[model samples]
Target: MTDKNPFSRRQFLAATSGVMGAAKLYGQGAAGEATPAAKLALQGGPKAVQGGLPQLVRWGQPERERMNALIDQTNLFYWKGPQTTLLIDRFRQTCPLEHVMTCSSGTAALHIAVAAAGIEPGDEVITSPISDIGTVIGVIYQQAVPVFADLGRNTYNLDPEDVARRITPKTKAIIAVHLAGNPCDMHALKTLADQHNLVLIEDCAQAWGAKFRDKPIGTVGHIGCFSLQAAKHVTSGEGGVVASNDPRFGPLLQRFGDKGMDRLAKGGLFEVFATNYRMSEPQAGFAAAQLTRVEGIAEKRSRLGNLLNDKIASTPGIEPHQVHPDDRSTYWFLMFRVRPESFKCERAEFVKALVAEGVPASAGYIPVPLYGNPVFQKHGFFAGRWPLKEQGLTTMDYAQVACPEAEAILKTGVRVTIHEGMGEAYVLSLATAVRKVATHYAH
Candidate 1:
């Protein structure tokens, strides 16, 4: 009954036992004997995922308490504001970076990192080709070039080998984007950055609370960027945080997000040119509250995600999302690959079959590589003209750019929705749904 240990051990057991009880009903098929999913639901049999997913309760009392505290505050500014201060304090407890800055959006956090890292016009930054345009928008706006590298077939994160091959004399930094909350192979990437004397920026927008090799993901790189957009693991509606333990880039984060004026300097001529991307105190407070829930949310999703992978591992032609044993992927949404040759169905049909069996599954991620977009193909940045290429500062041509593996990934990847505290029974049934559909559709 202590404050720190509020729940009794018996109560904890009772709660978990209920979830375990349901799991027994949805286990994999027994050898030879008929299982509940022996007949495929796509063929007029019962659906596997009985009892739809539990409704999500993303925010409530914790968020409201923080909001109430803000209501009595005198200002909404972020400079030394208590809410912002508390948010940063709470964040550091999790990520533990010496210098941190909360900003307007994840894109802003990265732009600050790139600008702080001193990327200049025509400087090349190697990154994944199959990510949200936000991953490169900062580099482009800084007048730097984003060298799109191929990715791993199963991991769906940047391929370190391809990254090393893309490195050139102009490479000033490498932005390692942890796509779908899966940690990139940071060890190889960090080695490449150090050997080449280039900065390594970890784009961790989707990977809140994820770890690489037992160390928090953002810590291994020089700078780490995260998103708190509504879709992320934890959110403040629209906010971001950038952090770095490196003294070289740590001190510059604040000014880059605050109009380039060093608040620590009190009153001095603005030396750095930047925009106002500061996050307000209200958003900061809300984000601080969300931080309290992140580790719990991450753990639940990680466990459930791995369980789904375990449940579906033996299905023919299916490649479960590949996560390193030492790394923790928060699984914003579990993305797996389906071998085309082993299936008698197209990707769309395979996804439809899973849906019919009551699994929330969909084919592919993005439709094409970042360079495949018309804007890149047309060399149309900055009102339909890219100055870096026009001024002869760069010789890059996106129209000729290609990453075959990345292109194939978007064609074969299947996204399965997972959530915080998703019951194990439901996860088991989701696996059953996949097994049923995959078995029926295999050649």
Candidate 2:
């Protein structure tokens, strides 16, 4: 070994393998990362799906076939097709929603929902600062102001108590998000929304099949928005769906996409002031096929989550995000908050070590707090009082609002995949990787 190059490639591989071996000695499950009999016990019986890891593999072939079938039917004249209508009906049934409309993307879905909610210029919409910029962007797109809310220290979801405090006379709506597919406290949020008569919209981008008290997440709110983006549970390449129980908002939202056309048949092909934000038939068809497996996929993820909890819960400096009793969540991303006092290295370094150990772990999902992003700080798009630019949208107030929990998450949270493809073996591999990395830093 030399100072410049202390270990050869072979030596490095050997040392890492040794580290993992030590971790397995301290961890649970199979010695070579196979599914243990104990894990099979969680499946409940032999009747359970046999192929957990391979289901995704099997599903892939069908998905390709459906995709190809759709491509063969595409026409350059317009995006309308039977596949689009078929998917709309399928989603309507799957979610059991009153009404569903396909949109170009999740952002478009959100904007349509906000508009449908009657959020006009200068209206205030409160939402957690820990989420993607969609909420803020949607509010701004509708010429409304977004009021940032704080998240709880325990679960990264928006704190209802904090949301209540943020409500002012100007507040018109509240956009609540189910972060990481964990359903938010809809009861508490609904109570507050009712008290204030505010329109409540559920950002279900991370949650497709999550439930709160046996009721699906998006259904609890007045309106819900779901993404079918590439990485999402139901992939449509780029698509979105907006659902609402209210009859009034449903058709209005439909009009938002088609420029005020009440019906699809009345137009001379583009009568409404609406831009072309319709979902493609091929994408919609592909997503419809994927939707058939959402429930089963979510169940497998839960089983894997339970296994990870059993093996890695006691590991020092590792605290997986706890689920509330009311929430039956769909796992989008498996998250573990690091207790750095018990470890020698930073969360970033720890994530790096886990990646090196063959686990796809990383520090993830840090949002540019709504008020702090360059989009709001420098106002060139909107018409208002631009303090910094001498003429534009009003400058955002980043002061007086703080999110302790969100700040910690934005700075230190680590994440890994909790996709349907992951299994008991993958879960054990992750646990073993975490243990090795934690112990290495502990020393």
Candidate 3:
């Protein structure tokens, strides 16, 4: 019978133990003798995974049909186009959001959210240190300070305690990024945002179908931003969407995305000062079709990812991606970390060994925290000097800013992309490869 209760970490561990017991039994010989260990792939042993894994199919009949329908309609423009409306309708059906505005890119969506929140120059927006620079690009463009906050050791999401500490009198908003499709602790963040009277924006670029305690990710924050970038779960080549349930941000979101023009209004008057960041009808058409395919993609990836995690749970020095009991991570890029002291080899060497075993894996994502980037360190957003910094409202220096936990994550974390096509056996092979490499280097 399916368990009605939520799956806690303790329960996961217990289930994993049973699987491990079966594995141990399978390894025993008929005479009750333990079988000899398999040879290491790095030592000329046969590779665990021999063939190419499944690739995500971006274009298909549904997408073609959508495009053909748009072409037949002859309304290529996004303004009042049926394609854009269809995409918006589809997004609303999928996500637990009341309002959505399609934009040119994920960065544009974030910029719109920032503007809709009414972030003024010199205001501070607290966010994750281990994230794409796009997360801060909008904040900096608004002439606001992007205060870096540390992440949790295991979850890899924004640490609520650290967020609380980073808030100052200048703080106006908090952009909580759900990195790698893992949901952040939204309950804690929502509580904190309410207590501080701050705007909460969710950067769910990687978290397309993820849920936090059964609630859709973007619904928790004041404004939730999504990416339809080529590499994301769903893509329109390049596009973005900003969603919100807050009545205050709904109208502002529409106005900001359409260059401050209220398209729904009776008159053609510019009500607010904003730039054009509108998504094309063609992109909208593609995204609408892609949205239909997301649930299947999420299901397969989640199943394979969970199984891989379970198989590798007992591997020494390796920790599977930490997910909350009530949260469902989409696993866009399956990530894990190695405890430095528990292994004889370094992270690079371990990665090399795993690759030799025919498992595709990378050492880590970004080499340094976003603050260590040249643009931020040089204060180079607007011609090498941010206007806010020039005005002397705050003296925060990115070059000197530090997030120790984020730094440590970059040093030890590893990632492998997850897709819908990978089968159960292929996932098992990945687990075997990880176990072989890690066991060989165990201290």
Those runs of model 1 whose alpha carbons end farther than 4 Å from true positions after fitting are: 1-39
The candidates, ranked best first by TM-score, are 3, 1, 2
How much is the lDDT of residue 347 in candidate 3? Answer: 95
lDDT tens digits by residue: candidate 3, 1-443: 11112335674454333332223343332123333357777889878777876665677998999988976886688877888998999898768687889999999999999999999988999999888889988888888889999998757789899999989999999999999888999999999999999999999999888888777779889999999999998999999999999998977898998889998898888978999999999999999999998777766666777667656655657767766666777888888888798789899999988888788799889878999989888988887777787889779999889889889888999887677778788887888777777667877
- Model 3 clash pairs are none
Q: Which ten contiguous residues of candidate 3 have the minimum total lDDT? A: 27-36
Better of 1 and 2 by lDDT: 1
lDDT of 1 at 305: 85
- Candidate order by lDDT, decreasing, is 1, 3, 2
TM-score winner between 1 and 3, please give it.
Answer: 3
Candidate with top TM-score is 3
lDDT of 3 at 32: 39
Clashes of each: 0, 3, 0
lDDT of 2 by residue, 1-443 (tens): 10011123443243223232233333333223322222121123221122233335425765787777766874622235667676777777667777677887788788888888888777788898877776567777677777888876546788899999988888889999888787788889999999999999999988877777678778988898988888777777788888898776765777675555556565456443445456767677777787877777667665666456445544555665555544566768877677667677778887766666566667957655555566555554456443333433433465545667677766667887777777676666667666656655664
- For residues 1-443, what per-residue lDDT tens digits would candidate 1 score against the true structure? 11011223442243223221123223333222133446777778888888766788999999999999999999999988999999999999889999999999999999999999999999999999988788899999999999999988777888898988999999999999998888998999989999999999999999997889678879999999999999999999999999999999999999999999998896688999999999999999999999999888888888888778756654667766777666788888998788888789999999988888888888888888999999999999999999899899999999998899899889999999999858888988888788777777767
Candidate 2 TM-score, true structure as reference: 0.80
Candidate 1 achieves a global lDDT of 0.85
